[model samples]
Target: MQTADALQLLLTPDDDAEPVLIDGLSIGAAARADTTDRKKDVTLEHFWDETGDPDDLEEQRWGVIAPEGAAGDRLIALIQPLIDARREAQGGHEVMIDRVPSAMSPEEAARWRKQHFDVSVELARDLPRYQLILGDLNEVPLALQQHQATDGFVGRLCFREERAYEAYVDKVLRWERARAEAAGGARFFTVHDRTAATTIGYRSLVQPAVAQLGRYKLDVADLGDQDEPSPDAFLEAVKRREPTVLFSISHGAGAPRGGWKTEGDQRDRQGAMSFGRDKLSGGDLGDAPFLPGGIWFMLACYGAGTPDVSAYWHWLERLKQSGHFGGQTQSVLAGLPQGDQRPFIARLPQTVLANPNGPLAVMGHVDLAWTYSFQERDTGRAMSRPSKFVEVVRATLETSRVGSSFRELLKASIVTNVELTSLYDDAERLGATPDPARLGHLWMLRQDLSGYVLLGDPAVRLPAMRRRLKKDAASAGEPGVRVHEVRAQAPLPAVGPAVAAERQAEDAPKLPPDMDIDDVERAIGKLLSGSPIKAVASEHDIEPKQLSALKEIYRKAGRAALGVK
Candidate 1:
């Protein structure tokens, strides 16, 4: 065997950038069971209606479904731009969910699908895929974005309530339009809470990912240091700044057994990112939101709603097969008979997107959040993995595809990990030396891959780059504030932006309690007038430049106060 291929079988625990399919579905999905034909006589139009009239299947592919509801009605209008784009690209082999009974047996009901549909064995990045799943959170299939279901599917871009749905969708459309014509930074805000065990990796992974995004020329703001002033202060910061992208890493509030399906529980727990031990739930934002429409990627447990049982049943079984079970079942595979095993309440993303002033979209963990999505263990060191979230953003901004490329990449990562465990199980039986790294990596990768979900529309396009006045190269680098270009190159490419400078965590800045410019200036004036620059800096416990700036500002204040103008 080739050394690289052999190394992967034992240690790397990832497919060498090549996609592997077992039976149209991923190898892990295929291993669970045979195709059962759950729904009978499927067609290209299951998600759309063709009876209204059409020219060709291509033209007809642009489904304009009017699902009834104030929010649903608004969703259609907001996504009309995407629909029109799809209608324009209506040629070549398209993807649709349908059954080819001929492949299985000749006796199945004489196939009612009027048009010929070929089931492609590949995950389509550009297929105009969509599903308008109406009903409660439990009624819908959370795996609507799962990789195994990528046969003819992608993210459903679900709308739970017509009101919030309309509000967010319209907000997205307006943000895109306004951004394209105006000069503005695509600011991305990442808030982290470092106090919990679930979030101990703040320094290791979360902060690094934030820096990486900043290098993408996204005006990135990271607000999750250990000495955070207060929850109110953090919340106030979020309200004060209008960023284009918001990414958070922390503990999400969750429902215990009693409150699992309650409205209050759903509103408070499912999407709220931790503020130390507490959280700021969607309801906390109140009716008038300070967020002015943009994308939000929240890395907390159940930031998106839990998926239907179908998403994780096979995965659970695989774990059980490999001699692991119980907790994984209770946490990840929880389901109810009526809801196809999906969670019973709408998540924080639902509320965030539904707000008339909330985000355009949100991507988050549907169940448990994990460090594996951002970092991996390598030779005793925790290394930053190529972020799956970064891939999702690329697919989102660059490709006009229907489903999440986020789910697809994560699936590949999971399948590779799962395959290793199965290999280890076989090795244990055969007395072959087992690679422990593969098994360790497996558990980390599985929950991460299955749990992430993109809420709001997957088809929502980022704002086009507005023309900007370029600063001279010498002054281009914003001081202290580091922002790299995030727009796919020409500037960044289809992937994420260039790697950022590794940010070393330093002790929090010790500023005065009552921060007044005038007070700072007085201190600067008193120290500098009687002492050297170093002495002034030492007395203020600040840098020389900082003292100098303060002195300059204080002198300017003195002139203004004296009415020298």
Candidate 2:
């Protein structure tokens, strides 16, 4: 067969074909050992059951975690109207908003999170469940957002200027106040990259999610297949007022085969959605009415933005060492923020949010995204677990808050963390090494889960829900749809320090009480000079785990401070 024909056949659509489960052969002996769970309880419903209806703002307070100093003050002032609206919605209650002094970058955010929430994330009850971050990734940091998301319904509001922020707030308020009407169904737009990731997402997630949404009596405009995923079609779909939710899957643009030329060029083009030979850049949308007042769930690498350092950088490096997907790995490497190019939110999302007619929220990945997120190997068998992905679609179509819907995806990560913690505790107790296979699997899952974030207000829901509620209210002869009022619950008692300390010691040990950033740097230098983890820990009067954790924290902080990844 011709090479072109062979490639086409391999990429042929097979709705009934089972997904490829096993990822690849192990790279080393350490990776061959298995210590993780065979079947992770990665269902989205479990998280919803535990967290309750985060969509109901009447019962849950909305919070904003703003940046510190003058910039934060200016941002808060720009969105003061939004705070007032949410407060009125909550029956004149104060919103839980605060500024963090040390969370401007991922490294600083990590330290802040470690100091506040610790390893296991448990938010104080008095704090709001629905949290909004009010700055760009560069201004507020992805680390702080991820930590808050571990337990709360969190989203962000980051735009290029004060006018854009004001415009977004206006767009959201107008969307909510507009009269409700029956709307078009959800739109499922997907790209056929011919790679396994896109193929499996199409077969497993797109097709299935479309079908499932139909079952919910929601209208769905299925825009999968070859010809429909172009930039023009995407724009047309966005132009229509109905279908307030667009769920798309695509390969985020990385680099030209030769690699990027300059940092400016890379930042401008990276993370654009690949539509065959055609691509969709944020600039392509202009100031046009794109997804006006709608919400989008974009599944692609850096669909949100590039982080300072990809969590999967070392893992992918190991894969490359094993001689796996060398070209693809290089492409991803080239796409990452390299050499003094500070992490920033993607241009597409930034432009869209800035546009007066753009989406209310854009849910996407902050780093390299792999099939590892939705596809998992089960007992030596590869399986597609699209439940979590599909649930987000369902929740959005059902008019749930975008942040709450994204939490459906976060549940899978939470499950993996529990399994990982269990494995670690077992290994520590039995003096046995955890299975390398299990460890790698759970680690990837956890990282992938943490990468998906919301880029808008956490409290915004689809306009379709508003129409439905209004329609119901009219039929019942009521003044309007009455939102049931509920009192804010008192703060829950924190976990006792003894238990918290014991858990911290078992996993990532806390830094020595007196050690500061400079002390951490010196300790890291000692470890780099061939000192064993035990020796370094002994010298610092800390556990080996503590030393290792401190080294990572210090390294990330130092690199970021030096304007390098």
Candidate 3:
């Protein structure tokens, strides 16, 4: 058994984190030890100072990592039983962790990750189709030397306290039991703006899927208008619908160190979803329900952690297309080498798992995410169906472990980028012109793979997908057609002939189909704030019912968005 002292010392992280020093060992500054309260204190040491909270646990893993050769083998021997115990409990799913052999140059590190990611990507090639991924996202030197962090690669996010992991597992088991008893099937909700080009590209490609793809009913809450996209709408939807799977897309809210309130600072909003003028910070979720057996995909920047600055350099070209260098300058500044100084703000995905009522697992980009990740070429033409991430995640929903799917998707993305790069170079050498779009996408794919991180139990399987909603031949001809299942009933709105006519007229308007609901609500707010509603509505061509829906949304959560009592 690992002693409290050994646990404390082994998990203790250095005050200053740099890439591997010449000697390979990080010179850590020692500090006070409290073996309890792992949730608040779990850290990589960069976020806290020695004089800070005295009860914080060192951010390092208690006993998972080990150097290559005999030492690593020994550590694995000790840890293998613990992991085996978990794998055994899961039955069908397996998570295999390999120690990173040694420290090397950044280039070598890239190769190292690529090699592992490549290995992970090959699920079902000769193995099971339900494969997932497992990673070691510990800090440098430690990660380089085969050590673990508070958060393991199995996708259980970060468990900060001594019993956090145990509690998380217990919750997962509870979720499994509930899933076994529940009558409903997998209910999924995805929220995103349709008007944004990136959003359109993503939704157009990812949303429409084979009806029988998974044992889940997919529901979407389109942002209708950015201003009208209320956080309440999402929360209410979750509360009402009780979606087992939730996917969100938007800009993440994060500012430099000083931009946040003391103790309740920017880290609170690091992976927060931007909703019109308002946002859903991790702190806001204190009142949210926990999705114990659920999986969340946060399609936003830094929803995980900011990866090595190199991850964002690929966007410079995309910025150059804006005909301004200011954005390019920021990209350059952001990507500038701040050696050994890794800027990692705590992320939202982990927060979701950390929540008492939060979900079982949340996967997201560690840094900025881009469109190229999901876009891939089949026979050399760009197409969006079956994105690497989507394929892996969907597989997990069916039969694989959370970590396996994440790892496999990550590997496929990385390998695809490498292949594209080689193809580009080959075309150039052969005196042939390479497609510029293909070249651009190559960078995005590579960057995306590097940042993709899953925070939750690697072994946690998505609730068994139940085919309860079979297609009705009379109303729907298809076999796997979707029909809403009644759970908790809500009162229907009072409707009259006049209201029916009004709704018909509203439905007939030429409104922007892609406008987000939140944006619509925001527009209504501006109107309430004394912007001529009739004139503005006419000019913008808003339909009557659409306009009414916006107002109704305001009624639901207007005061909060407007920032008043």
Candidate 4:
């Protein structure tokens, strides 16, 4: 059998550049799992149907979430103008902007999510369907945001200055009041053949998605290749600002071959995109007009931001322990940031978002992006899974709000998680070893889908072309002009208002406030060891039902779901 490096050499055209699949994980790691027919059949299209009527403004409630207490209060005050504008836009609909429990890390975020959103019995559903987070990864934490986004529309805005927020709100209001020029045009830019990630993304995902978009009659521009892969050309395209949607495929700047000169340098440049030899950073943008009144889907690693830690950290460590791709593992590990530094929203996105002339929202990967997101090979055959990517483009082109479009992309995580759970259950039931390869594939799928997030207000959408403009064009006998249509979404199953209250009265246990998972497990262990129920309940200050619930959680999803790992 060929070595992993040798296989990569066989597949990749450029010897100097590693294949994205290899960069993401070694061939040996990929070889661990194969021919999972279950995962192969799972497709994103099955969950593409949106719930609730698209035309109903009432169905689209909007809210802003931030950190709890002083920090959140200050941040909210800074962005109050934007919040007020959004609330006014909602008209009669109630818009509540609230703060989440204080959480500075993913684990803390998980705890807060469990206490609120993940409860088995939801007592109140007061918040809106669309939520815009109001801080960076440090303030609110990406884990909490990602969890909320699983079934709801979510976006984030992080700015260092109050003036930036003021500028952004003014920009949003201006754009909302008037239609953007050539709003129906969608542009695709790619540094083609540069790396495996870019090459496959353009050919497999971008091409197919564009072909699908042709049915909507949106003007499409496909540009970027070795000859035209300069930052100047890309900047010029953005300066034109004609397209309401811009899609690009390239490498997000990672740790250099020699490593970053300083931690500050890494924070600023880690997520920048390389155009030939030139790099595009927020500093490079410098308050310039970039995708004004538009949306951007940047397909690159850390294009959105870096998490406090990579979700794949543990999995990569496991692969490394398996004794293959020693050097390759370290190369990837260098990018899988641990506790060495603080997580941050990418500088490029932050700068553009705060600009007066900038995109309304950006959809991109928050962690190390890989070809695993769009291409699957675990079923023993290479298959393209571009529906998630296509769904975002399709929704945006159809005049859906950027938040709703982002939710469409995230729906794949639900599909992937369900399959992952099923795989876990089967292994447990049969008392058989779980297939490592199958687990790896499902894990990657879930992480890849979960990594995508929105950076901006969820309420923002591509502006509708003015009615007068449309009428004038019609009088000129403009043929084949595409009109935006509001397609019906299947309504979510109706829930009785009293049903949740009743369920909470019965099954909902009053868990001790902010109890960590390890503590819960210790209590469970004592109970299993034949300790008195009343004694355990009293000792933990939790209801007996709470203990039962915690045990079930442990049995099913393990302690990780509860809190600290």
Candidate 5:
């Protein structure tokens, strides 16, 4: 409502600062659909034409629409009034209408241009407000026409599709609707108020509490740009300062030449891949420095994809091990279509920044899809909206009652569930039998118990399988299936020949009178560095305390000691 409030809402969590939801459409789905004649275009058109008129509608509402025909008029009618109402409710605070383009056809283009002018006139004639038209008008005819009508109009528009348009509308309207409801004495929307009070303006969709979280913008280095920042430069930037969230929209490769290609054949028609190496190897992520204390939203494919070898490490794994990020840092909302990165990149920052804490959950496709199958979970809700994901994250974060390591872990679980679903779909297509061992272990690690309910198939009792796994582990006298024991490796401290010989002498069975206490300590230190003190003391028939005290002396001398850091 206030200038400060508007400014705060404008600051998003991601770097792109683009709206996640535009004109009530989900950018991710729209981008995916743009690649193919998928549900994005069809659904958008249906919603726009079939849905009720925004001007005639009374309830505080939001919906998606096609850019053609009367759909744009309905959206304009619906959104402009909400914006006006928000301004009035906020004590004459001016509302801003930011329009993003959603169509490219000449006919559709003209329609969009007309819609904008009509909406602008409505705003000017009805309410005291300001509007900012952003994004490209893809249709050349409309651009030319609009340019002829008003100077600089072409420059003000961006050619982004309808998905972005609808998403922005939804966010703005929802925010304003919430504000209007909160301030109730003089209703912003009433049957009697026809002209001045009839219009509703932009509302702040971001929750007041959640809006306080730190915001950031995620601008990925363009790999194709000759002047673009190198991986090292990017790493250095990250090392100097870390954001609460990192959203990367760079290109990614899968495994090496011999490994399976998850998306498509990387090789061109001439059998040449973009990168020099064979298979699905990624660009030089290993060389990049990671932000230790932040969450990474990898928009790249295979950034978290598993490696080919059994024990070999992947880039995500290495990043996780580098101590720059938590266990969840390696986690990603992957499998998104390459084209959809722009919309995701634009909206993610705002969604994350709008939350009181960092995003408690991140959801992404394992593979690109024109239709967002994930949204089936929330039926009747606007499928194209960005606020859907925002709502899920908000609810998840609130369940924590604040924040905790467990909550972060829960966030990881939800992200993993989404990834697993995508993987399940992929595996089904590839005809790979679901590995019960892997599935069981993953189920055990899941922090959200409700996830088990979503497993859908009762045939695979993950809990029972995990129990069997535990029994096998106990019988084999090894760590359980889900646990991995990594032996620590580092060079031993250098000791002189005389010191080593003294240590050997101390180690040799000798009477107490000949034993040098310092030499005994050095020998104990060297032994403890490699083996546990309990094992060493028990094997050599010495008190654990004596072994501990001796080891402490060497530790004081700057020698290496092994244990948890």
Candidate 6:
């Protein structure tokens, strides 16, 4: 069976069977290794050198031990069973590993890693269906550096001291030996890439999206260097590139007031140089190129905000209206804190590229307040980007599936753990529950409601209910009959005087058929001596205007026909 089909079956399990087990170095395990009381000697400063820079110190700390409560633990717990079940159903395969000896001295660590890597490559040569994932137990690269590692091999060796190096070597040897013996049909390889703020940020936001979908594949490309390919270059390099959904993370901005004659605002620009027009106009956006047959996501802030100036809607609005993009495009996620763009940008690509459907939905905050948060108490969640990213993405995706529209999905997906309160809750506390009718009306006015749907409780099943109402309308030959269910309790009983008053009013004498306007007026004056205008209007089936007109007619003419007044 295909991987997608296998994964789906695994996710939606049968009633009778037990869930499958997924084994890996969980984020939680990594955290525990990093934080045990046994690591007291590993000071925050020990990882640094005479330069007194904390960068290297932080990297060494993370490399040695994982943080407490890493969000990756929760994610792995959620998806491991599904992966295991899928593998089991697909005629279970074994994973092979080449164990590297850690009993060797510090000088031999590199050689040990190289030997294992060669062995893993040899084993992988025969299996075309199998994929390899590799990791270096020692010499953590700068990109992977969470805080900062020492300056060089000499720094790291000195930092490790005497017993530290031996202990690490022993740990690596044991881990590799155990993995190699547990030989499966597949071979496990490790590749190390440095982590940047942007990549880390993107990972956090995309995790929720991935877990929410339950069954999907992800292809991650780290865009860390400014010197690397620009967004346009990456867009052009897509080969066999018929993706149904596309998402991008970059700096964005709005146009200035004086057309192209002035420098445009730097508010939302995602690092791309802007120079076409002096003031930057929507006209430039209209001319901007876009990919065909894919939805786009702009993780940058203010990219999709209202079009006060020409540049506001030129990019986002044009992309949606252009008919080339599939479902939706532009910045659906919120911006980063204090105008930092890394986290939001990191998640956009992860979310869009993972789903073959090409991002039918994009969920994110519009402001920096929502996108920025710390992973651990110290060293800034900003520094350990991926862990934070994984948390946000997972939360967003879970929320997105529960609602129909991006906003609703975002509101639903708003992650509110015991530790973190959601922005939606804050808005609610401030009394900002937007009128659902008004929201629907606005969407209708925009005429972009086809791809957009409200994200809310699935139990409501409004669309199905609406369809039933439509069917009833069609069958009854009534074009506009609306059928809906609303819960209401019986009203309270009327008070004693109110009840008596209602009875008296009901039993009052009827008006004379031959009475003129003057006679009727006299009767009303006598009956309603101190009653208010509201009571008079309620008693008669006429409006205030009709009552006034009758009163005027009575004053002008005598009661000649009835002869009472």
**Highest-scoring model, lDDT:** 2
Can you write out model 5's per-residue Cα lDDT over 362-381, one digit (the tens) per residue?
22211111112112212222
lDDT of 2 at 388: 93
Error of 5 at 518 (Å): 49
Point out the higher-scoring one by lDDT: 4 or 5: 4
Cα error, residue 77 of model 6, in Å, equals 50
TM-score of each: 0.54, 0.71, 0.54, 0.73, 0.20, 0.24
Which candidate has the top score in TM-score? 4
lDDT of 1 by residue, 414-517 (tens): 55544655665687689885454544454445546666655554444444431222234554475644458776546433221111111111222434453444
lDDT of each: 0.44, 0.67, 0.44, 0.66, 0.27, 0.25
Better of 5 and 6 by lDDT: 5
Give candidate 2 misplaced runs (Cα > 4 Å).
1-52, 102-123, 227-229, 322-330, 466-565
Which wins on lDDT, candidate 2 or candidate 5? 2
List model 3 lDDT by residue over 210-254, tens digit each.
333343443323332333556777776455324255555554544
- Model 6 misplaced regions, further than 4 Å: 1-226, 237-241, 254-289, 306-365, 368-565
Q: Tell me the deviation in Å of residue 339 in model 5.
A: 30
> For model 4, how does the per-residue alpha-carbon lDDT over 1-565 read when each residue is reduced to its tens digit?
3322221210121112343344434544754433343343322112112554332233455677888888788878877777666554444446676678635454565566556543443323444667889877878878778766766688898887767777777888777656455555688888654555566677678887776565554677787755657887788788766537889888777766666667777777777876644678887777677888888999887888888777766666665677754545445545445565768888888888888788888888888776777776557545788878877876786556788777777777787778777876787799887667667666766777788899888877777531111123332333444456689999766455344444543554544554644446756766666666655554344578878777665443433333333
lDDT (0-100) at residue 295 of candidate 3?
74
Candidate 5 TM-score versus the reference: 0.20
On TM-score, the stronger of 2 and 3 is: 2
Clashes of each: 13, 6, 50, 2, 61, 60
lDDT per residue as tens, model 2, 1-565: 2211111111111111211111322323124322333333222212223544355454567878888899999999999999988876654568877777633444565456556433333444445778888887667777778867777788888776689899889988887766436554688887765555577677767776765555454577788557445677777778876537888887777666666787777677778777756767786768888887778888877788888887756655666666643334544556667766677788899889788778889998888776667666523444667889878877776566788888889888887778877887798899997777667666766777788999999888777632221123323434432456589999766545544444444665455554444435555776766555654453333567877877776565555445456
